[model samples]
Target: MSHAKLFHPKTPEQLKRAVARCARLHSGTEAGEGIELLQTSYENNAISWFLERAKELPLGDYFLWFRKASGITFEDKNEWVPELPVLAGVNMAVVGQLKEIASLSKGHLAVVSNDGRVAVVMDSYSGFLQAEPSPEEIVYELAFWNSLG
Candidate 1:
């Protein structure tokens, strides 16, 4: 098996644990072969800091602005055939988790599933902004969990 590192949380439990760890003290634990969880301080939250300066725009608006500002349109929303209600359930669960962590700004974390791949345009009011498909590529991870059922 390939030891690919995971940067985003794939489940509610995983997201919860990551939030807790990211918020609390970190001892440089080994998440995988090349993943290292580090303690994030207020100073490290430069994106959040910068976002705060703009009075916290909506996630969609921010996404658009990011695209315009950077002049780079990322991947388009993919089309996927969901497996009945499982995909929807997993999407809701994961989105809820992200919102709970205060990492979501508005209900704009559009989760699109297609061809066994999940895409996300998630954002945070805390200045945690990403270009597209989510910075850590975690939004696309819903496919893995959805496939388990």
Candidate 2:
């Protein structure tokens, strides 16, 4: 299975860059052969398009999600789960870590998370992605997915 995670870019430009880097990162890897990005406009709101996509997924179910740093917040029931606060509110620390990954990758980071709390950073030049989640995050994500059932 493809590793899934939340993505939050700070701006549309970052989103675009991230997506492009994702496309490149996946284009070469056998595991990512089918990876694709749905083109969306970010003219008015930076994450409006992404939020709409997130809304389409079933609540409490694990799905690939992302938001930008300093992005808008969603009300309860508008995010991955009804009880969980908006991803923006709870995931800034994760986003902060991702920002460091992006910088280290030289802006070639694609925000694919295997769990909502962890990110798999793809290095475009090397065509490798890595996210070593803490044991606690792993167990939490397992519980989270189990709760979805």
Candidate 3:
């Protein structure tokens, strides 16, 4: 897989150049195979590096789930579970305390927590889909399916 470096811009020209570079890099790759790129303001270099390169270098999708409060049930025995929204051609379902869903200026999807404590941002290209479920719910579901084997 190819990788691109994100530059820190000090002027409009630098910013333009960075955008141009990003466009060129994107253009050069085959469809569905472009390099995953990330950018952030330089504050803590370690955090910056981790935030920028974590998703791409690992070459995998990251799953985020919130744990439910006590006495919550994962299964709907009497009611049918509805389908989640399809984003970038993939299906996504929200569980737990997600308050809002919005696309960022750059077209990335952001899911905000109900308490406003955290937001989960997903890349439009990387197939990072979101689902809302308590960790226990996910585990139980997985276990139920795994028992078929």
Candidate 4:
């Protein structure tokens, strides 16, 4: 997989510019590789009536953008489906134990039924911005993920 350097931004304008650049870079790839860009703002939730809530957006916040987006849809917000079909324009799948995804770089994630068709996932987002993998490397990783399954 090819690795690319990430340009982290501290301002909204910089984030938008980075997103636009990612959009352009990803447009040249194959049709089935979906992409998304996400902004990670830490939030805290309270459980029941006994817990207190806390939230914070880091001083130097990180934006994780996906080079290949997914298009998996759900009928019920709490429902889960494994092995969603590959969309026509995007073939990357968000495997492992993820419940919801936020934004996409390109096409939506879909479920390919046993008969072979596409079912798009709605209200979800995929793509993370962190130090683990650069945006370019993420694209390669998605490609590998698509190829494997």
- By TM-score, the best candidate is 2
- Once model 4 is optimally superposed onto the true structure by TM-score, how far is the C-alpha of residue 143 displaced, in angstroms? 10
Candidate 1, residues 1-149, lDDT tens digits: the string is: 01212222122233223223322323244222322222122322423333232222222111111110011234863232111111122323223233332242231222323222222222222333244323432211000112212
Q: What does candidate 2's lDDT look like per residue over 62-125, in tens digits?
A: 2222322222347742222211111222233233343333333322223322233322222212
Best by lDDT: 2
- Tens digits of per-residue lDDT for model 4 on 1-149? 01212323221233233323334434453334432222221211101100110011111122223223322467743322222222222222222211233223222222222222211121123444464343432221111111112
Which lDDT value does model 3 have at 140? 13
lDDT of each: 0.25, 0.28, 0.24, 0.24
Q: What is the TM-score of each predicted model, taking all chains together?
A: 0.20, 0.23, 0.19, 0.19
Which portions of model 4 miss their true places by more than 4 Å? 1-11, 29-60, 63-149
Q: Model 3: which residue pairs collide?
A: 95-132
lDDT (tens digit, per residue) of candidate 3 on 28-55: 5422232343332221321333233322
lDDT of 4: 0.24
Report the Cα lDDT for residue 56, model 1.
23
For model 4, what is the alpha-carbon lDDT of residue 145?
Answer: 11
Clashes of 4: 34
Q: In model 1, how large is the Cα lDDT of residue 140?
A: 16
Give the residue spans of candidate 2 off by over 4 A. 1-36, 39-42, 58-149
